[model samples]
Target: MSILITGATGTIGSLITARLAEAGAEVKALVRQAGKRDFPAGVTEVIADLTDVPSMRAALSSVRTLFLLNAVTPDEVTQALITLNLAREAGIERIVYLSVIHADKFTNVPHFTGKHTVERMIESHGVPATILRPAYFMQNELMVQQTLRDYGVYPMPIGSKGVSMIDARDIADVAVAELLRRDRAPTALDRVTLELVGPQALTGAAVAQAWSLALSREVAYGGDDVAAFEGQMASFGPSWLAYDMRLMMAGIQAFGMQAEDGTVERLQAILGRPLRTYDDFVREAAGQA
Candidate 1:
């Protein structure tokens, strides 16, 4: 069966696309610009925009399964809904949605709320779907690589409260499992939601220590300052993005972002191996640097 993966060039989506293609599935990568990047040998590149429903029609043709991954933008809700409605119209058999962990509880956060809304739409739309709600990505630390190397500090606004950050590759593995399972007997995962998290919950200090061990340097936890965080984010993007991120960080500070009990166990069952730990990710990242 052919599978269409949206956001096919992104961190998690690229991993899923490669794995699916490696498994010999007919993989169609939905890219806004087709010739920009190379894909797996057997993968087909379909030029389409999620916001334009008419443009997606060709991409959804003959697609049995779809990995819906929308960008975290202000128009996330509209974009997802448009694509989902088109997928349903195209008679797609299965959908795997990449949502955020604790999206239901974090309604105030724009991106989280958008995912929750899309999840509901998937359920009500009668599409057999698996929702993979993953925690904050451990790879997110790569964003502050410069600061870590120069200042020896982990400069995120996650605060002292712990979060069960996970590796994007693990999330991709689980997504591939769900997509490949269409040939197997119907399981509990159909129309089910799973929280994907790492082996342990870690605070800012723990993250700093992990980096220190990996880089062989003294790395300290930079305290959470919303204003400073917003300013830093704004330098790279728009003021609204910084504002939204500040609110997300503020929410994380007030209410921790730890995973639920048995989250790791569930992920292990899907992966058939131990979940990747923060230290493991750190060591690998350090090696690449």
Candidate 2:
């Protein structure tokens, strides 16, 4: 059975698919569209949407390991519960699901709450599961790339709260490592939850300084009005996705998004190499630019 990668078009999911494909692992991508996006060589792409349980089940037919990524949909609750049920029915032996750090505690955020729901569903199923609870993605850096380039700065609601902002690519690296050679990983699949994080934790001001140094521009942060941000997002943003980010950001501004333990040792212990740092991430983004 091949590895079934859901949300293969997304950032971390794409990285996981590529890393697995490059390593010559048998992977089948669950996609809703074919020839719509580029993927790695020797990767099989299957057209399946998470909303359709039968299609998802069909895609999971011969899959042993399932890498589940949260998909933003208007009907997120329905889709998430159905997907978990189908995975169980398909007899998938292993599940590596990506969830946020404060998934279990957050309720204002519908998406995170749904993720927590999915985690519970996975637990109810007898399948061996590895839940990777990563903090906020560093890839959000790209959203303000233009702002950074023009104003030479990055900004967020991060106050004194030091968060272990993880590189999504590193999260993907961990996912591929955790799933590809199952027996070689931490071996705590069923009874454990892994928190993936970057090399260091820094405040928003500290992050701005890092960006300033990296891009040679004085990046500044601007935000204290949670209402303002939420309003802006709700009005002009993608319908289903707008609130998820706002609710998560509200938690961040209020100090709910920070990682409990330092993430360096655990990250290093898993990857056998230093996890990617914010500086490295900035450099990679700069290179892409």
Candidate 3:
């Protein structure tokens, strides 16, 4: 089964690509530049931009399956809508979309609302797709590792409400499984949505405690301060994206990203194993520090 993986250079997409290649499936990575040859020996790389319709058309050529993962960008919605239309035109058999958990609930977040719009489009257009709505990725913490080490503070402002943080690896595994399942089927499968989550729902204080245990030092939970978080994010990236993330964090603080009953069980059942834990991820990050 030949599959086209968009956002192929990204963390989750790269993991899916490697796993698919290892499983002996034909994989094609859609990259924006021609210089990237990072895939395993047999995997194909297609130079295409999400916003470039012709390039995307060429990338979708002869591809039976597509893994749609668009990074959070200003034009993410346009990219997704255009690509989905192109995939539909290409008569792609399967599509696995990486979307955020509680996209519908996070009404104020730009990226969240963007994905929700895409989900609506897929449904209304009768696109044969599997939507994987994963919770906050534990790997996001890797970005703040240095801050955690230096300041002895966990600064995501996740609040007292619990969030079930899934590992990016688990998301890749579930995506690959669904991709292979759809690719090998005799006919197109029905539209499905999978709520991917980790084994435990964690709060801000719990995360800080986990980091404390991992580093063998006291770590304080940074209080809910969306403005401070926004400023920190804007220091390194665009203000627009920082504001978008600020809204996302605010939504998390309000509603939390907790999974429904049996969500974790269902995710484990899909993977046929236990999900990776936040504590384990914390320990590894701390050890690296």
Candidate 4:
């Protein structure tokens, strides 16, 4: 079976590509640049703009499953819908989407809303679909590591609502299983909302504590102040991303976007093994750093 994965160079997408290749599925990756290849030689690299239907269709031919993992910037919604339509046209039987937790209610945030829109598109498109809605990534901790080391601050707009931070690798494992399973019942594929999660559901302060231990220094948790966090994000990202970040922070704060335990148990059963913990992810990331 052939599988097509978008966002081939990203953190999570890279993991998905590698795992699918290891599983011996014919792997195809859609990249925007023709000359800029970063993954293994085994992956079939196709150059196509994700927003272009004709371009996407060329890459989607003969693909049985598509693992959707693109991280969008500020762009028109029609661009994404067109891509999904192309996926359908190319005879993709099953589609797996990487979505944000609580995607349905995240209208204020452009990125989360973007994910929700795509999920809707997938449901309407008549393809077998499984939506993996993971919470904030454990890899997200690395963004503030240097700040915590230099200034002892790990600020979050995620608010007091504890997030069940997930490791991207684990999410990849789950997605791979969903893609490879041939006997998936229609009821199983109808509307699967699997909340990929870490073993421990920690508050923001607890996440900081893990960082402090990893860095061998103190890391303080700054309160949920949207303006301050937006300022920090603006300095690093484009203005639209900063605006999207703030809107997302508001959702996490008000809706308490933490996952209940059922999702974790479900993930364990699906994988036929225990899930990785945040500590395990932190050690690997820290070692790489």
Candidate 5:
């Protein structure tokens, strides 16, 4: 079975590619540039951009399954719609989309709305799809290494709210199960939405404490300051992205982005193992640091 993964070099997609390859499944990574990025040795590389319809259409050829994961960009919805249409046209058997936790509920947030829109497109277009809505990624903390090392702070705006953040590796494991399930039983997991999250719900302060314990240094929560968070993000990314993220953080602050009930149990059923805890992620990250 040929499985093509978009965003193949991204956080979740790259892990899925490696896992699929390790499982001896025929994997094709749809990268924007060939030879520029290194993929798993056994995986095939297809140079195609999501915005480029013709290129994407060509990439979909002979692909029985597709892992659809687009970056958070201004044209995210447009790109995803184009890819979904092309995938349907190519007669791809299944699609596994990487979406955020509570995407349907958080329609006010741009990225969340964009993913929900794509989910609708996949369903309306009659594409057999599985939507994996993973909660806040524990690996997202890797971005604050500089701040954590220099200022002893965890700079996310998650506020006092506790979020059930899952490790990206867990999301990848669930995605691999869904993708491979198609081969084992064609009707299994069709048009299913799985919310993936960690076993525990952790507040911002708790995350900081975890980091302090793991790194053996003081780490403080930066508090829920949307303006400050947006300013920090704007330093590295586009203003629009900063704004979008600020809205998301604000939503979390106000409404709390905790996982739905039974999320961990469902994830454990799929993974056949316990979910990775925040402390486990922190220890692994500390080792990397």
Candidate 6:
């Protein structure tokens, strides 16, 4: 039985797909359209959209494991619920869901609330799944690279509370391990939840300091200004999405996206190495800058 991956074109999904395929596992990637992207050799491309029932059914057919990752969209709830219900109908043995950290607690954030709703359904229905709750992606800094280079500022409004920003690559590695374990088991594994996070929590100023060290110059922390951040986001995308992100950022600023104690130790044991640090990410980003 093959492992089917949704959101397969995205950064973390792509990494997981490539690694699974390289490990000689049977893999299938769900794509909205064909020929728009490429996958590693021996990986099957399953043309499907999350909202298209017939297509989703075909994609889930004969699949043993699923990596359920729906992009944050207006209809994220509908898409995820539909795909998940279909997975159950198909009797899929294992599912790995990518959810945000503190999804249940972040009730005001649209995407977080939507994921929490899905999490509730999964728990209520007893789906054999592994829920990976990851914190803010360190790679998100790539979007502000130009700003950092020219203005010497770290522009994200992650505040003084501190966030344990995780690496997408590390998330992918943990996902691959979970998928393999569930898929190779003789019977379906029990449901589980894993909080994915970086090794240490860093505040906005700390992140700026890391960039400063990496670039050998002073970099200022762009203070917590969710309104300004929202306005900036709205200039590039839908206002509603920007507002939704504003709520998420406001929540982050108020309550920091921190991992529980010993989370780092547990993650290290799982990956057989230390978690990736923001300092390393900064150094690499600066080197390329």
TM-score of each: 0.95, 0.91, 0.98, 0.91, 0.96, 0.99
lDDT of 4 by residue, 15-79 (tens): 88888888777888889986575777688888888777677777787677778776767664566
RMSD of 3: 0.9
Residues forming the 10-long window of minimal summed lDDT in candidate 5: 182-191
Model 4, runs deviating above 4 Å: 182-191
lDDT of 2 by residue, 221-263 (tens): 6655556566666676785566677777777766645565656
Model 1 lDDT per residue over 41-123, tens place? 99998999988777898788778888899988889999899888888888876888899888888778889888999988888
TM-score of 2: 0.91
Q: How far does residue 18 in candidate 6 sit from its true spot (Å)?
A: 0.2
Q: So what's the TM-score on candidate 6?
A: 0.99
Report the Cα lDDT for candidate 2. 0.77
Cα RMSD (Å) between model 2 and the true structure?
A: 2.5
The per-model lDDT (C-alpha) reads 0.86, 0.77, 0.92, 0.78, 0.87, 0.93
Instruction: Assess the local accuracy of residue 257 in candidate 5 as a C-alpha lDDT between 0 and 100.
Output: 69
Candidate 3, poorest ten consecutive residues by summed lDDT = 34-43
What alpha-carbon RMSD in Å does predicted model 4 have with respect to the real structure? Answer: 2.4
lDDT for residue 124 in candidate 3, whole number 0-100? 97
**Superior by TM-score: candidate 2 or candidate 6:** 6
Model 3 residue runs over 4 Å out of place are: none
Q: Put the candidates in TM-score order, highest first.
A: 6, 3, 5, 1, 4, 2
Q: Against the true structure, what is every candidate's RMSD?
A: 1.7, 2.5, 0.9, 2.4, 1.4, 0.7
Model 5 per-residue lDDT tens digits across residues 57-105: 8898788888889899999999988988887788776788898887888
Total clashing pairs in model 1: 0
Task: Give candidate 6's whole-model lDDT.
Answer: 0.93
